[model samples]
Target: MNHALKERIIAQSKQLGIDKIGFTDASSFEHLKDSLEEQKAAGHTTGFEHPVIEERLYPEKIFDQPQSIISIALAYPTKIKEKPDIVRGERRGSFARASWGVDYHNVLRDRMNKLMAFIKEIAEDEAALTFKPMVDTGELIDVAVAQRAGLGFIGKNGLLITEEFGSYVYLGEIITNIPFEPDTPIENQCGTCTKCIDACPTGALLGDGRMNAQLCLSYQTQTRGMMPEAFRPKIRTVIYGCDICQQVCPFNKGKDAHFHAEMEPDPEVVTPLLKPLLTISNKEFKHKFGYLAGSWRGKKPIQRNAIIALGNARQKSALPDLLKVIEEDPRPDIRATAVWSVGEIVGSKGNPELEAFFNTLLTTTEAPEIIDEINKVIKKLH
Candidate 1:
């Protein structure tokens, strides 16, 4: 009901450098619950979503007397200016655009915190302005709130695609008791273009602005366990996240934004050399990649994905490194994945070094699963 407050907030957002801002009522998103149930029933969930579905559908369940939700979008850079130097033996792996620069969660939280403070400062009664800010880890689906807030329409890739930033944007929201005037939602702009769905490497996109999260390469990379063999090749050289769906969307052609300097990626950090990751200490990984959003799962998944990338690239020069992982790595998943990657690198070409290595490994390796993988690699290669 407060038109002036809404306008003031919108104007203040420009000063705050928020790419886009929109407001919507905090009614329950009951329509999405059925679809979410269906996805869960079909075993399509990534298991990373908020476990309680009701809390996700209804903001009021978590926030007291929520009357409106303010959605925000911050454009992130899609391309790096400086490319990492990748020579013959020093091949590098990539982190997706979302992982570029500092973690987006931290960046968005900073902006939202500023905006929340501004709202409280200008409100009729600062003490009465009850608000809850949320980033990616929030119970509410970010894209849903953004879509309803008129920031952008949901693309077939299940990403918010604004006219200005396309899908290269980070989303955040604040649930509040203020009864602000809501904005009109944007209509889906993706009419006949199935580029994102067609280009999905793992067929995760289901054509209706929804995705099978379990099959998504992005989800697979984040998973801590050994990646299924089927998804390994599809991951390619991406250690942290997958950008195929966003990259292929027609709206994203040459869509790069530099609104936030903190979101700009460092080439060496984002596209790190693959071999060093095999033996990177926890301390070294934290020092190098702890700040990025992709580092949330820690070094194990990234290390596993790096090994898979080496195998997919058939980086024969990385054979010794992969072998070293099998020999000394503490985690069984890391060791097993390296063994599979070693097989991909060595192939049918008889490597007596690999033959001798596996023959020696069979006796010393205690884990039955790892020993089985080593035997399989030896049989296949030699």
Candidate 2:
């Protein structure tokens, strides 16, 4: 493509709400292959490991007719007013700022569609070619694509960090048959900054920008069914995704943190009081979190997360809610979490309810794991 035409297309993308845009020749991601292999070998793939990723990593394989990749970045605002000093010491319910509003996958997809329409207009005027758009939903390594397209450098926290937006942005791409001039990739800017690594509660981020997904609090909270014992204490107050790494990044300092009005956090979701959450009816749960990305994991994981957060906070006010969940929740995982939370809150005073609930559960349930967990909590309470 002509340099002038390429520049115009990029400029149009920026006008469509994309913060940064650039071009790259569609090619195998050889630069990231070794690191991906290392992640797999180190068992960081966890639930995300799939054969499709291996094949798609080879860009030649992904786009048989493709000539170039157009990468775009959409900045998600993170500007929330700092909490007042009086509330700073309270137990904080954390959600990664990216997920604070409507789902980014939906938001980015809508913008990508607009960009694709713009591309189609240009293509129609110039060459008769087609373009395919892919957001986080596809198999593409979006971060690698963004880096190759000169948008930003990948930070040690395993996030794409732009000089202007830091790590607070969402990425998407368009693979087109029309070849375009490529841009130079930026150099890594994370020099001597181990803040993200040191700040991580679960130590999921390695020094080399690779993440141990199995140990990641974000992954664990969204995981269905039972969680391993080792990760429980590490979860802290994070009920959804963890933001410790991004929060500590020096690049985010002094940047605009206000979110798009559509992305504002629901007051019910921000630093949620645990007592109300545990006893929330299914209808109420859906009403409160229906539009949230966290809701995709459903009530069990979220309720379990609330229990854990309550346990960590040692909030005595949550006792009634925990008791109700322990006695009535049909999901064994949620019940198990409630039992644990009850033990954490009432401690020595937990004898009466623990005995009553344990007796009721023993007579009614047959799942070995659930029964065992309840019994364990009962023993601890005694």
Q: Each model's TM-score?
A: 0.97, 0.89
* lDDT scores in order: 0.91, 0.76
Report the number of the highest-lDDT candidate: 1
lDDT of 1 by residue, 1-382 (tens): 9899889999999999898999999999999999989999999888888899999999989999999999999999988888777676678899999999999899899999999999998989889889899987989999999999999999998899999999999999999999988999998999999988888888899999888998999999999978988899898898988889888888999898988889989999999988889888999999999999999999889989999999999998998788788877788888999999989887888889778878888878788678877888888985
- Candidate 2 clash figure, as a count: 3
Query: lDDT tens digits, residues 1-382, model 2?
Result: 6687787777887677677888898887876777778777778876554457565586666666888898988777665554423443345566666677778777777888887777667665645666777876577888889998999999998788998888888898888888899999987899998999999888888898888988888889888777776777677777888777888999988666453555666654655655566667789888877777777777777778878888877877667777777677777877777677666666665577468868787898876766877777777767
Alpha-carbon error at 265 in model 2, in Å?
2.7
Residue pairs with backbone overlap in model 2:
78-257, 79-257, 79-258
lDDT (Cα) of model 2: 0.76
